[model samples]
Target: MSDNGTNTTDATAYDYSLYYSEDTSFFTPCNELDLKAFASVFLPALYSMVFVLGFLGNGLVVCVLVKHRNQTNLTDMCLFNLAVSDLLFALTMPFYAHYSAVSRWTFGEFMCRFISGCHHTGFFSSIFFMIVMTLDRYMVIMHTHKVARYRTLRAGLTLSAFVWLLSLCVSLPLMIFTEVSGDLYGLVCIYAPDNRAWKFYNVFVTNMLGLLLPLVVMVGCYSKIIPRLVNMKTAKKHRVVKLIVSIVVVFFIFWAPFNISIFLQFMQREGHLPNECKFYRDIKLAITVTETFAYTHCCLNPIIYAFVGQKFMKRALQMLSKWVPRIHFPPSRDLSEISFRRSSVTSKSSDITSTIMM
Candidate 1:
């Protein structure tokens, strides 16, 4: 009887060991997600919403800017290119939505590479344009006298092209590495770093080059602007400054979480972090949630532009005048009351223009 009892206890203990075994994903050659139905179901809806909003908002921006392409100023040029980047990025969301829903790259390998490259390309270009846009604002506010020669339409287009090229250079490596592979239960489309060293460098370089540098430039621009804003007596200047500040804050809010999580992931993978089961699970969850949050940043800019950019609001009203028969604003009203401040062609003259799109 005692022998039988001992055997039964041993069997129970073995079953417990099986139940509590470490998730071997931590030791695997590649990162794997033990995804549940929750991810498959929940993420599709969010991605869809982002796609819809992003498309509509960015489309409107393109339409408005292109219609007045001949008259577009430096800031208008920035807004237009920024919208282009967002629109391109948003186009790839449906593919990702399907990927999220199915947890597979059903579109095949070419698509796996193409779609991934496009999104990252758009990601880099958009942020680069944003950084340039902020720097343009800084130049206008602080060194208006010296900046006019370089803020021309030709200059802006050249800069935009340069940014796009830079984006392509940054994203090309991702295309080479992206592949579809089977992880125990299913197939995954992932960035297949060749080794641990490559993986670490990939995470380190992408985030550092793509995120950290731009963030510093944006922050520095806004920090300098803040003191000037406080000293300004005009309510209109305050409003413009406030809108710019809000834009900077929103950009940081959406992007910082995702990149910070990437840093944590690097640490954990490198054994700098404790390998607790719950911690790993939470980090994985955070990455999924935060990455989706980051995707929304592509579309969110137009909403902010619409609400806060008073001049842009005026132009929207003008556009609506055609569709809404009774709607009309006086021709004498400020067409662009609060433009990004700029100086005239002559360095000798400090004549500033108050033309921003409404």
Candidate 2:
């Protein structure tokens, strides 16, 4: 359990583990293998796929939102912002992919900081906007009368500004601490805290804000929404319930494992859990694998939230058709029917569903 002879060149291969404690320094080198060898091959390919899909899917969402900016409502505004956040997140993947593939930080110190900042900012902002969307849905369904005045275009802009500012603030620690430095793995970009406390702080912040808080809010909001949807006899109610369930289920499925893995690692580093070498290696591998799954959640955002919407798909296809003249797409039967309303209190439950989804 000494750093003198142990080869930790492969430790902490990506930014995901930048906050992880250097426990390799204490790990006994008995029969040690290159745990990160799998990462060098597996992660680059997965990251590349995530980057391409996230960029294209989110790019299309952005294009559609912009094309109809004048008609955007609170829901549309949230979707637009979410897509932008994912786009920002997707842009950082290639740099990380290169770092993973080669185990070097060739992007220099500034990019090291910039990309780290951008990555966390995107992550925080995406989750924050989803929280906003959930609340928006709650208000529209359960407190329709009161939400009208507050769900305006002006209100959405203000909320978006606040969320962006907050996300930047939350990510500042990683931004300020991240640097490119020479390590056993050669030059690497990492969030190198000066003390173990700072490392622990990073993990605590990510776990609380990135997963725990959002999960609570989502569960609370959807609990009210599901019963409300169930009480209604309209056919559209089923679709609304289905979409709500999908959102919550997908978010948990994609992110929970990753968060749990890192939290366990943090606990082990704190000596609260057994520190056996086999357990340590397993947890590290789990972090790498689960982090890859978590990163791909951004790619699924557009699909679950936007593309599945009948009206949104129609509009996106119409936009695509115009861009590619050879490909014909059926125009929306009645664009006016899909227009956003200033209030939904007096509207039917089905109308509320369409307004939120469309």
- The ten-residue window of minimal lDDT in model 1 covers 9-18
The local distance difference test score of model 2 is: 0.80
Query: Cα deviation of 67 in candidate 2 (Å)?
Result: 0.7
Tens-digit per-residue lDDT, 138-207, candidate 1: 7876777798788898898798889999988877776666665544434455666555565555575557
Task: RMSD for all candidates, in order, please.
Answer: 9.7, 3.8
Best by TM-score: 2
Highest lDDT: give the candidate number: 2
Over 4 Å off, model 1: 1-35, 321-332, 336-358
State each model's CA lDDT, in order: 0.66, 0.80
lDDT of 2 at 199: 76
